[model samples]
Target: MTPLLVGVLGVFGLFALMIFRTPVAFAMMIVGYFGLWILEGSRAASAVVLTESYSAVSNYSLIVVPMFILLGNISSAAGFSRGLYDAAFAWVGRFRGGLASASVLGCAVFSAVSGSSVATAVTIGKVALPEMKRLGYGDSLSTGAIAAGGTLGFLIPPSTGFVLYAILTEESVGRLFMAGILPGLLLMTLFISTIVLISYIDPKAGPRGDYVPLSQRFKVLGRAAPLLAIIALSIGGIYAGVFTPVEASAIGAGLVVLLAFGTRAINFAGFRGAVLETLKTSAMLYMVVIGANILNPFLAVTHIPETLGNALVGWGLGAYGTLLVIILAYVVLGMFLDGLSMLVVTIPIVFPVIQQLGFDPIWFGVVAVIVIEMGMITPPVGLNVFVVKGVAQDVPMATVFKGVLPFLLAMIVGLLLIIIFPPIATFIPDTMFG
Candidate 1:
């Protein structure tokens, strides 16, 4: 009967729906609508739903979602992913464990294209896994690298995770995008270093790649240039204040579409398929936003976030100790829930605790995103690991999980560095926007 009780029921019910195979978006929408009805009657609930849905859909900044999704989809359809992978291979494929390293690099580059971790994993895995196998690379190392690398999609600029975090917390999407850059590169470096260490311990696990001539490398790099340039122009333009995030997204998508057709890399049929895929993905994201918006209001009325924040701050745990608790909780939730689901479900409660602790919001965003990406390759529900498994069909799921263990460790180290330095996530944003 009490609002707080309804809010508690709504949280459990949301998880129950998700556990029962209900879509996260619809589940949130459902729980929030009915809970509001219970707390304050149907008119408020209906109005909340109507207004939030319209607001979510009509928000101009949100245009970035479909545009970026289209940019990624079109790039995938046009075979630009292959071009990027090939360029990476040419550059990094000569050293020990280089093929696996190349996969990481390829994922990092392609992360700038696709904001979704699954899309990044699948696209690069399709290209990198086969070549690694043919070159006699070990399954665990190859699959693990691709899976780990794919998580860059969640941490890098143009990331869906950032966009959703922005919408939820009302942070600047552009600053969050900027915040992600160095941390993403830091994680990429650590992943490559992990491959190096693995190779040093077991050379046969990651055999050295054959030589690639300088001329060949440059030639392949040239082939990969258009998409890279588009990525640069779009992301760079945002930082340089040359364009807004919405404009940058539209420009990126338009340029990729032009490149696809101009190079004859994608036909009308392929273009149509890309558009349809974009529509589906964008719609799902939009619905999630709407649902989160609707649910946030109900949660606010119950004062659950405020209560949690107070409880957390009341504890003797210092800022770092409280942070440790939150991170550990995320790891547990991540084992059962997908990254986006974990994100939306927790941020309302978590964000307040974070802000009350006097931690930097932008910095925490990177930390939160990196931790979620860790979940993408973690055990049980490891989303990116399964994506790599799906692509590298012969590799066992356990092998994929085992392979990611080292990279996951690398991610932790990278995360720790960010937590300690803080500048790793905030420096660029402060320098750019200040």
Candidate 2:
């Protein structure tokens, strides 16, 4: 069989495994190794696997992955998310649908620290949803807001998705992180605006609430200082060249540890849990990266991407047309696959095509992340919606899905703005690094 045929089969088979309830990492690893053995002889494929695994794991740049994860784990353990949400509430909670708006902004801030959508959804939903219910917010609107907002974790700075994308594409991780900043904020604003508009049109959807006292507001803000400090130090240190991205991660992790202690939030038991969780999660990320690294070379040998890329470019779809195709593909895949796994599965093939079509890699990374964010809130496998449902078990699944629709529309707008303007995502990265 032609190598191209083998590559195509591998792609479909990987999806089949995922649909059959296989773990994403295991499915990718199995298909990749098996495909390699078929394309080359088993002996050659085994040797390549051994060497690639070692090289991928030993690469020093990868240490940033664990450092960032550790930072997030520590912050989560320290209860930083609650402070962020509280502060956001104090500032925004007086508006009609104010709590829902606060949920979006709060999720954005918590996302900066946690960088995991499920974590953001559950954490914020736990804290914010019941409050919204008590305040008479509609169940659909309340559940949907948190579920949709949680997806910001993937697009925002300090994002694990962006980090993984940069590592795979060999883009500058710092620049990718920087590129995410504005677009992330833009999406957050869009989400908040959507909430306000919905509440304004149908006041019954979200009731107005009493404002927090100025003194209490200040107290909430004070509680958020540590999180704000860590965000500023980590992002600012990298941008200022005071430290490399890796060093910034180390510094961030260190700060989170200190914050945990300062807050007296981490007992020995909590600390051990944080460490073990970070270690376990980090291992999973590394395994996926290593497996993708092994699989990428095999895909390359097939020349399938090159063949498809040239054909699409020859079709003269122009930049926008090509981008539409990519986005459409992501939307479809979002239904069946988890976002990170979808990214890994497609990026090796798709990124080269994007670069060939003259799109900036950093900009494309942001665009790609936004597309994946859609998947997280989209059905029938919207991961974020499921997370929200877990938090509000009595809320129907359909209601959770319904809640995300407006934000999803806002996300669509945000994605289009990034596409047309480009600089919205690229400006910071270019100015800082250029």
Candidate 3:
């Protein structure tokens, strides 16, 4: 059989494995190893598997993954997320829909430290959800805000999504981090605005929260100061050229650990748990990275990306038109696949097409992340929506999904703005590095 046909069958088999409850990493590895064996030989397949696994695990740059994960886990154990929520609430909770808006802001702030959408949603939801419920905020608006806000974890600096994208595409991790800042803040603003609009249409849906006094606001800010400092030091160090992305991760993780210990927020038992959780999460990520690396070569040998890129080019859609088609495909695929799965599966195929169209890789990285973030809240498989549901178990699934729609629309608008003016994603990296 032709290599292209083999590649097609391999993809089908991969999906089949996924449907049968196979882990994505192992499924990709299984398909890739055997596909390579069929095309080449057992010797080459074994060699590829060994080399790729070792290389993927040993790559120094990958250290950023665990460090950042550890930072987030440590922060959660320390209860820093509560401080972030309190600080945001102190400032914004008095206005109409203020509690929901503060949830968004809190998610955005916590995302800077946590770098995982589920963590952001779950952490902020625990704090903000109860408060919103007490204030008579509708379940839809409260759950929607938290779910939508959690997506910032994928777009903000220290993002695991960006790290994976950089690993897959061989782009600069620091540049990708820089590129996400403006777009992250932009999306946060849009989410907050959506909450405002919702409350404006029906004030009862989001009753005004009690105003916080200046003394209390400052006190809350003081409580959150440590986390804010960590964000500035880690992300800011990258911008100032004081640390590489890996170094920044190390610094951030170390500082969080120290803070947790110094404040006695976590004892030895909690610290041990954080380390164990970090190892588990890091190992999972490493598996996916190794699997994608293995699968990439098989796809390359089969010339699938080349064939797909040429086919798209032949469709006679101009650059922008083809780009739109690609974006639409992501929107559809997102309904079923999680963001990382969609990203790892498609980038190998679509990135070549993106390069052929002359779009900047850094800018595309930012745009692609935003698209993936949208998937985290999209229906049928919105990961963040499910995460928020787990936190707000009393809220119906449909209500949570309903809550995310306006925020999703707001994200679409932000995506459009990024497309129309690429600098929205590119300006920071250019200004800083160039």
Question: How much is 66 displaced in model 1, in angstroms?
Answer: 0.7
Better of 2 and 3 by TM-score: 3
In model 2, the runs with Cα more than 4 Å from the true position are none
Per-residue lDDT over 11-40 for candidate 2, one digit per residue giving the tens place of the 0 to 100 score: 888889888998777787788888889988
Q: All candidates' TM-scores?
A: 0.99, 0.97, 0.99
TM-score of candidate 2 against the unseen true structure: 0.97
Clashing pairs in 2: none
Candidate 1 error regions (>4 Å):
none
TM-score for predicted model 3 compared with the true structure: 0.99
Stretch of 10 with least lDDT, candidate 3:
14-23
Clashes of each: 0, 0, 0
TM-score, predicted candidate 1 vs. hidden true structure: 0.99
